[model samples]
Structures are given as C-alpha cells and as structure tokens.
Target: MNRELQPLLDEWAREAGVPGASVGILHDGEESLLTTGVSSVDTGQAVEPGTLFMIGSTSKTFTAAAVLALVEDGVLDLDEPVAKYLPELRLADPVARDTITTRHLLTHSAGFLGDVDIASGWGSDALAAAAARFDELPQVFGVGEVFSYSNSGFLLAGRVAEVVSGLGYEDLVRERLLEPLDMTDSWFLPWDVLTRPHAVGHVLRDGKSEVAHDIGLTRSLNPGGGLWSTAADQLRWARFLLTGQAKDAPPLSDATRALWRTPQRAAACPIEQIALGWMVTRHGDAEIVRHGGNVSNLQLSDFITVPAENFAVTVLTNGVGGGVLGPKVVDWCLENLAGLPALEAKPVVPTDPAEYAGSFPTGDLGFEFTVRDGGLWARMVATDGTIETPPAFEVAFVAEDVVARAADTRRPLARFLRDEHGEVSAVEFGLRTAQRERSRLTA
Candidate 1:
C-alpha cells in the first residue's frame, strides 16, 4: 500500500464530512488501501480494511456477472425476453412486456421505470413479487429507446437467475462469484455484516455527520445495491475485473466479461455509453469504466476501472456528503500515478433557444424546465421528497441531446430527445425520466 496517500484520503473524507471512509487502488494488478476516520461516531472505532461498507448499486456488477455465468452455461439467453425464464414477468405497458429482453435490461433500455418505489424489506420473495408488480409502474420510454438507469431491471434479472439456478439471488452470487474470488468477509445481509467489524451509514442531518437510521438496504433489493464489503474485498473484485480471468471462469466467459465492459447503448451525454454493469467513458484517449452507488442519505460507493492502464480505484464512504471522494481519488490516481490526463468538463456552453419549458415526470423526480435568458433552465423536484431543488441552473450542451447542470456533473445527465417532427419530446433526467408536463410553469 502507498502509505503516502493516507493524508490525501484523510483530507477527502473530512471534505465529504463523514465519520470515516476507505479507498482501494489497484494498478497493474497490485493493490493498495488507504482507510481513514471512524466507523461510527458513537463508538469512535477507527475504520479498518476489514470493516464492511454497503456498496449500494455497485452490486449490479455482481448480479450482472451471475447472469452472464448462466449464459455461459447455456441456461440463459441474453437476447430472449426475461419472461421466457420468469414466466410471471409483467410490466405496465404490454409492448414493453413483450419487447423488453435481457439485453435491454442489461443495457438500461428496457423502458421499465428505474425504481419501483418499493422499500427494502418486502421479505424473501420480495424481488420476485416486485417483478410481477412492474405492470403497476410507468414505462418512461419505448423499449431500447433511451438509457434510463433501472434498479428494478437488475432485480428482475436476478429473478431470472433464481429461476435458472434454483438458488436465491444472494446465494447464487455467494456460491458462484464470492467463493471463487475468495472474498471471505463480504455478505449480502446486514445480519452477516453485524457478525464482523462493519460501519454504519452516516447521514448529514441538519448539517451534521451522524449515524444513519438504516445501516443496510431493504433485504430484498440486495442484488441491486445490498452487498456489504471491505476495501480489500472490493480490490479483489477489481483485480478479477481488470484481468477478466478467474480460477474457474465457467459462469462468465471471457467474451461475456468483455461484453460486460463494452458499451451496450449509445450515450446522449459526454460519456461513451452505459455497459451492462459499468459506465464506459473516455478520459482523454484512455478508456474509463466506472460505476457510483448511492443509498441516498446512507452511503455512497464508487468503482472505476481503466483497462488500458490496468488500473482500478474504489471509494466507499458512510454518508451522502462524502460522495465526491471516489471520483476525486480516481482523478488523482490516473493523473499523478499513471501519467494519464483525466477528463475535464468543457466550460458550460448554453444551448440556443431550446424549448425545454414546463415539467416532465420520472418515476421519482420531476423537472420543471423554463426558458430563461433565451436558454434552457431546469429545477428538479424529488417526488419521493428526499431532496430540495436549489436555484435553477442553465442546462449546458455537451452534445446534441446531452446536457448537464453545471453544478452536478456526476450524472443523471439530462438527455433531450426529439420526435419524428424534429422537436424536443422529452429529456431523460438520470434513471427517472419525464415528458413535458406543461409549456409554462404552473401558475
């Protein structure tokens, strides 16, 4: 481990305003860990490499790999509709029900709402039930039309795995992925985490970094973002991904592993596109594949892999404020360590007289876009009421349909799409998408 990086890690944690955080870096298959801060304010126990952090949506990578493993075994078909495996599968739109396939789900083009607004502990049968209840949720886009991040899609994918393997989602992953990788300490349940040294999620309550009420994701969604792991285990996972090889690589073939890293959908933003479980993008000439996981107020984790340089970096923190720690560390590693130029955003270039006015609905959040200064401006509102929108910012054009609010560049990038009439139809705001609700603000 590069001990010299400790100070910077400590600084990043403090900036993120967390009790403690951990970072894992892997370059050329070598690993280093820099852990700082406390696991809990109540205990004041220093964070350790063994302490588990809930990795949130990064678990999608695990789930994706498991399904790919079945694909390799001739038990699953990537092109076939998920209903083929899970006979109970249904969605709100019958077209989506018939057209959406495993490929669409993996690529985030299945048209299912990103999330079903279902809480975590709906019981052991929760994911299966959630899959059956998709018909109750809205379909934001046509099948394969846009990339909308879908937690529900991954869960349904897990269900397909369950049907093919006759094993629970967590067990299938544990038996197939974890045991092979020799990750002894990682687990999908909070009960298992409690048996080991683990960190509770910290939240910013009234501008204070305090322990969060919920330490783990709802029990059923474990396949989506429920795994709790240490920095060391994450490094092991990164190393496996970096090499795309394992001792017994039956489940995920080399070709499928490469497919997991390859972009499956075209991007409307500055990024290249969304791969199965990774975000495939470019930083200068070097390709970067990464994913960030957030349990909203509880925890935020990030994993980045730069395959060209054989480099990977992961940041896991216990609170919302510390979300920036992962990418910042990534920028540092690539620039100073690898002699690579990290991606820097071009200055905000305001779009010309775009009619993004009025509101659009996503599963959870809605956006009210207005014409200001002859340019497009957007104020986002959370339907779940978890966040409050600040003053509107000018939506900057980084590409034809891709736009980003200058302040929050981490994504859920606004992608403006056009109809056959060549007019802006709807803008995809993150995973939750909405069409225009009105031309002018509701008076």
Candidate 2:
C-alpha cells in the first residue's frame, strides 16, 4: 500500500479543511490503519486510529449484508414483496404498494422518494412510524424503473428485518454482522458516539469550518446512514465483502453474495448502474463495488473493494469535501497500491457540442454546460441567488452521454432524459430531476 499515505493524507486534509480523517486498507489478508488531522478542530486534539467517525450511507452495505444473511437462512426471499413481511407499510401508489419486492428496495428501484427528511421524536416505534408516512412520498418512477438512491427504501428494509427477526434493527445488525465479525468500536447513536473518542462533523461557511447541527443521523434513519465506526472496523467490513481475502468465512452463501455484487438492471427504460446496495463501476477489466455517504454533507465516508486483487479502502472525513476525497484516494489505491491497470484518458470532441450544452435547472439551482478552451465544462449556478457555489469543474465526455472529471468517474451524474425528437429534455440528478431551459442563467 501507499507507504507515503501519511504525507498524501496530510496534504489532502489541509487542502479540504478536514478536521479529522481515518483511512483503512485491507490487501491480501493484511490490514493497515492510518489517521490524519484532529478529532476536533476546536480542541486541536490529535485523532487516534480508534476514534469514531460517521460512515454515512456506507452503512447501507451493512444493512444490505444483514438482509442477505437473512436471505441465506430463508427467513426472507429476495423476490418476495416487502408487504409480505411488513403489512403495515404502504406506498403512495398502489401498484408499487403491493408489487415492490425486497429486490426493489435493495436496488433502489422502489420508485418512491429518495429521502424523507422527517424524523420521529425518539420512540421505539420511530422507524415504523416514519415508514408509515412512506405512503406520503412521491413516486419518481414506476417500480423497478429508475435507480434513484433511496434512504427510505433501506429504512423500510431495516424495518422488515426487525419484523421478521422480532429484533430491533440495530440489534439485528449487531448479532448478525458486528458480533460475528468482531467490530467493537462501532456506534449507532450520537450519545454513544460522544462518549468515545469521536470526531465532530464540520460544514464550511464563509471560508471557516463550523460544527454541523446534525452531528449524527437520527434513530429513525439509522439503517440508511446512521452508523459511526473507526477506520479499522470499516476495513474489516471491507475485508468481509472481499470474501476471498476474508479472515472469516462469509456469512452469506457464495451465490447470494455474488448476486448482491452484480450491477442491477433498471426496470423501465435504460438507467444508470447501481448494484444492490453498492455501486458497480468498471475500470478497464476490473470491477469496483463501492459506496459513499454524506451525513448532511458534514461527515463523508466511502468504502471500495476490488475483489480480484483482494483489495479494499475505507475513508471517513469530518469535513465538507468528503464527497471529493473518496475518488482521489480510491483511484490512487487501485492504480498505485493494487497495481491495477489504469485506464488512459483520451480527448474526444462531442459530435454536436451544443447538444450537450444547455441550462439544466433543478428547482432554484441549476447547471450550465459550456465550452472552456474547447472542452466541455459544467458549472453550478444559483438561479434564485440564495447561495453561492464554487466555480465550474472541468468535465469531459468520456463515453456516450457520460462525463468525467479528473477526480470523478460517475457520469452522466444524472442521465439526460430525451424528448420525442431525441433532443435533450430533462436531466436526472439523483432525486432531483431538472428540466432543460432555453437560456442559461448565471450567479
């Protein structure tokens, strides 16, 4: 692995204003842990390898793993409709109500809202109550259609595990995945996190870092992105996912595990690629299963595994730029650490540059694609003037309708929806789909 990861991490932590970060790598049965920055910028205490940081949506993989374990035991069927397990659950749409299955939820094709921002007031029935309101969530696509990321789906899946096992979701995870794997430094509550050597999440404002109000995820949303864990524990989790390199036997069957790792196909028209609970992206001949989390854009985490090489990397940052840090670290690890063949970059001009250029508006904020030095560039603009965004990042077309930055590979970011005549009509950006406007606006 990168013997100089310390200096490289120091540079990134300084540049990104990260208060604290822990990086863990598991390669060919060996594990290494490293730390940089401080647990608290306010106190200036150095961060230790055991210090806990929120893993965000990366927690989704654990939720997925636990469900798969249940599947292995025949307690749950992958194709069985979720309503078979949780009868109280209801969707805004009836078709999706009775038809959506465990498969849909894990793959994020349940066709409901990507996020439900409402939280219960800390009751034992918090997850259940929040799930009941799921019927109020709007449908973005039909069941098994588009691959919109859904926290509500996983939360519902967690409730299913609770109902089937007659155990709390937290406890179910503990018994099934944590205890068996021996991850003692992990936590699921803000209070528990505060009691340990923990890092507080930070948001940047006016060129300064400030503590985030939502330090940890709510109890109701625990299944989605609520877990806080050390980098060491995270690497162990990654090691388990890389079964060949795993220290212990996998908790799920090889067939079931292989099924979960494969990229899922969208039900409706063609859509972007997302594995059951992770992202399966191609880097030449190698396939990467990775997941990233954003805890209110405060704490950012990413876990990635390259199965062929028995390699994995987990990163958690208590800062705003956690979104950008993961790709940089993973690319370095894959190429420099694992010695994987790096995909060479090629310069290609779009057949019709204006076809890819337009005003893609999402509510009040939008993106404007323009030519910069004859290269395609995407810029973020505040249409209503409420917030100021950074300057545009240079994005180049890497494939048909796909774009990539030097540090970014997920592209089309949102697939560009087409009109009847094949002109770009709308663009899907995760949960927020924006329309193509006639003229572009600037901040």
Among these predictions, the greatest TM-score belongs to 1
Which pairs of residues have clashing backbones in candidate 1?
56-225, 69-251, 91-135, 92-135, 120-218, 359-437, 361-434
Q: Against the unseen true structure, what C-alpha lDDT does each candidate score?
A: 0.76, 0.75
What is the TM-score of candidate 2?
Answer: 0.86
Local accuracy of candidate 1 as per-residue lDDT tens digits, 1-443? 36667888888778878788888888766788888998898899999988888888889989888988888888989999877887777778887887888888777778867764566354677677766677777777788887767877887788888889989888999999998888887898766778899888776666677776665446557777889888888888887877755546544667877887888877544456888777787777888888768775577888888888888888888876555677678778888776787555655555564465677767666777777766677776667765433346666666666777656543436777677988777766654445666465522
Candidate 2 yields a Cα-based lDDT of: 0.75
For residues 1-443, what per-residue lDDT tens digits would candidate 2 score against the true structure? 45677788888878877778888888767888888888777888788998998898888888888898898888999799999998887788888889999888888878787656447866678788888888778776788756666788899988888888888888889887887677889988666778799888887878777776666457888888889999998887776676722435656666877877778764211233677787776666777788878776678888888888888888889886776666567777778888887766655436445666788764345668776566666766656553335457766565566566634544334356787998777665533445688764332
The candidate maximizing lDDT is 1
Error of 1 at 242 (Å): 1.7
